[model samples]
Target chain A: MPDTIAPRSADAATPPTPRMSGVGRVLVAVYGILALAATGRTAVQIIERYDEAPVAFTLSGLSALVYIVATISLVAPGRVWYRVAWIAISFELIGVLVIGTITLVAPDLLGAGTGNPFGRTSTVWTLFGAGYLFIPLVLPILGLWWLAKHRPAPETTGASATSTAVTPGASGAAA
Target chain B: MIAWFAGVQIAVAVVGALLAIILGLLGRKPSDLTMGPLILVELLLIVQVVISIVAPLVGNEPSGSLLEYWVYLISAALLPIAGGFWALIERSRWSTVVIGVVCLAVAIMVYRMTQIWFVQGL
Candidate 1:
């Protein structure tokens, strides 16, 4: 079998696979792995030593939550789930940048006598998202790219233009 | 030792990644590698897991957080197995991406394992 799975071309009358295919599939798989990673780390912190760095530990928990949501959204089928995954991914991007920066220059704030106030700040975002060698940093960029690959319809001229009027270059009044 | 084993793992990952690249260039999809080298990588992972589980019992802790080290090991082993399955089902350029990610992940694990194995810092 060729297994090309037919990329969603403009010619296609039927909609593309509602669920992930191609790169999206692997993306989801990575999310699943990261979910496992973050979940395990957070569980360990909470159960073994919650007092060591509560702030860092809390962020780990939050990241874990985001990863779990992303993973579930990635694996499950449907438009609603896709939107949820997008939301989780967006939050992941924000979390990594914000937390990564905070832990980097403001080590004194997130750090502790134990060297980690939030239960040993071991999050995907800490240190400019270096924990995953910046993949935590790059994932959002790739996500947006993958989302773009779907080539959602131009919204400016659509009947529901009110919803997406703000879309870039939507106003074709001059044209 | 897991550290030594990691070096070998990296070597294997590089090879797997290269194969994925070559196959991708040839218009071969992820499904092409599903039953071939991909399975071999999974087999290597199984061996890796066994060695990792047994390593601590037979020897002293490497140096860093042993739990953390094992976490990397366990997850590393699972990467290709799950990734390969997903690739098989999806069968797109993404399979090549999976191989790339696995290679990257293994390299990172090797680096972390090295840090824990040799370094004493937190």
Candidate 2:
């Protein structure tokens, strides 16, 4: 609620702009961790055996990119970043659902990607993120909720360039 | 990957978690008192990294992909410090919770490293 711990000096012409704070901090932290995990896993998978499962590995790489973008957008302020965050989070949700369903219903489809006799390939959203305690599945939903709560006010609905004079901390109070 | 190391990791995580709970109950932020256990865990993790790196070079063939082990070790070693610095910056009670989460994560990672060492082979 409060912009920060200390009281603002009278000369403070602009209100403190809230990029990330309170519950947002926890959200960003989780996103940051997931981004790192996905990045690391995809990097290792691609480097070690890219040819073994190109499709699966590429999906993993895409998932990693989504996580990275979501984390950055969440950390940035203004209406533009807000929209970017929504898009990234929505894409992530769709990816998990599509990948999870395809992996389950049609293992044969991705079997070529695995190349193993059993047709087993693990992506970030495989089995609804069983490997990561379902965080991958649950995170985007929470992100959406947070984004809805933090949507920009009507006056700041313009693009990033036009909202430079807007006070973010004042608007964040609505969140 | 050693038994004692894994045990210590779990113990440190448990200690950090309990400390964080105490701070929550007392309505406290991440002050010096609450951060002590996290600092201790960070120290232990650094020690583990040093030993893991040096032990292998000295012909102690650990049973796992050395690359994976190193990544896990380095990440584990950094987790608490990163959390600590964030807590200092945020100065909120949730910061204490962040430290707790990092400690738990480190514990899980260490366990995974141990499993990698045993199951994956050197």
Candidate 3:
């Protein structure tokens, strides 16, 4: 069995690491939902009343784009995708923090003034996502942690090569 | 929207969330016990959709932005289906928790929907 499986591993090379397994799947599920939500909010804000708060609506659109990218990157396979996930999630964290603080301290800057035509301008990161229960603030942190934990094995490393070579045989045996 | 029906949906969603979370804490994988509540929530959401369509025609219109109300309702309906698919693919304790979280979110969204229908007008 080992002889047959070892040859198969060599032929297959290193199979792309499973990023969407176990806890990561849960992360992706949350990300997908957030992506859907941000996109929906952006659509409504921009299409319904873009003129009322252009800056705030544009910011909402930007967050929607970020969420969509992050969701896809987290689900895609390969090292390139892993790097993309890192960049997108990092940007999301920064956006949430910066926007959250701004919304809290000087919401008028985002058109949250009482006299504004459309109540307060809200986004996914508004007030650290108070409207959405702060999930926006927390999700990127969790995503960064998940990415750090699931770093792809270095392809050039002899040790990693040996481990990858061993995995298939073990899986084959379990099968 | 009928007040009692909305109240019942919220109650069921909250109960479902609590049940799923408890099962997850016990380290239980995806099972009928975990999925049942989510399915029930989905059914209630379908009912909610029907009500949303018929109520406005019957002179019970939402006071808020109609687009906003429908978007929230549609998004709320999708959450459970997505969570259930995740649980089916990855049968784990965490997936159970995900279902719970989704249910809780649905409850909140449903509450918001009621608020839109009854109070807020744009």
Give the distance in Å from residue B121's predicted Cα in candidate 2 to where it truly belongs. 4.9
Report the C-alpha lDDT of model 2 over A64-169, residue by residue, as the tens digit: 9999999999998766788899999999989878877776677546645332211224677876676667788899999998886665433333555456557575
Model 3 gets an lDDT of 0.82
RMSD to true structure for each model, in Å: 8.9, 8.1, 9.1
All candidates: DockQ: 0.23, 0.24, 0.48
* Top DockQ hit: 3
lDDT of 3 by residue, B35-122 (tens): 9999999999999899989998989888877788888899999999989997898778989989988998899888878877887664
TM-score to native of every candidate shown: 0.74, 0.79, 0.83
Q: On residues B15-78, what C-alpha lDDT tens digit does candidate 1 reach at each position? A: 7777776665565666655345556656766786777677779875566666766776677777
Model 3 CA deviation exceeding 4 Å by range? A1-16, A113-120, A156-175
Candidate 1 TM-score over all chains jointly: 0.74
Model 2 Cα lDDT, one tens digit per residue, B34-63: 688889888888888777877777876667
Please give the clash total of every predicted structure, in order: 10, 4, 0
Q: Residue B96 of model 2: what lDDT?
A: 78
Candidate 1, TM-score of its B chain = 0.76
Q: Which residue pairs show backbone clashes in model 3?
A: none
Q: For candidate 1, what is the interface RMSD?
A: 2.6
- Which CAPRI tier for candidate 1? acceptable
The DockQ-derived docking category for candidate 3 is acceptable
Cα DockQ of the candidate 3 complex: 0.48
Could you give the fnat of all candidates in order? Answer: 0.29, 0.10, 0.42
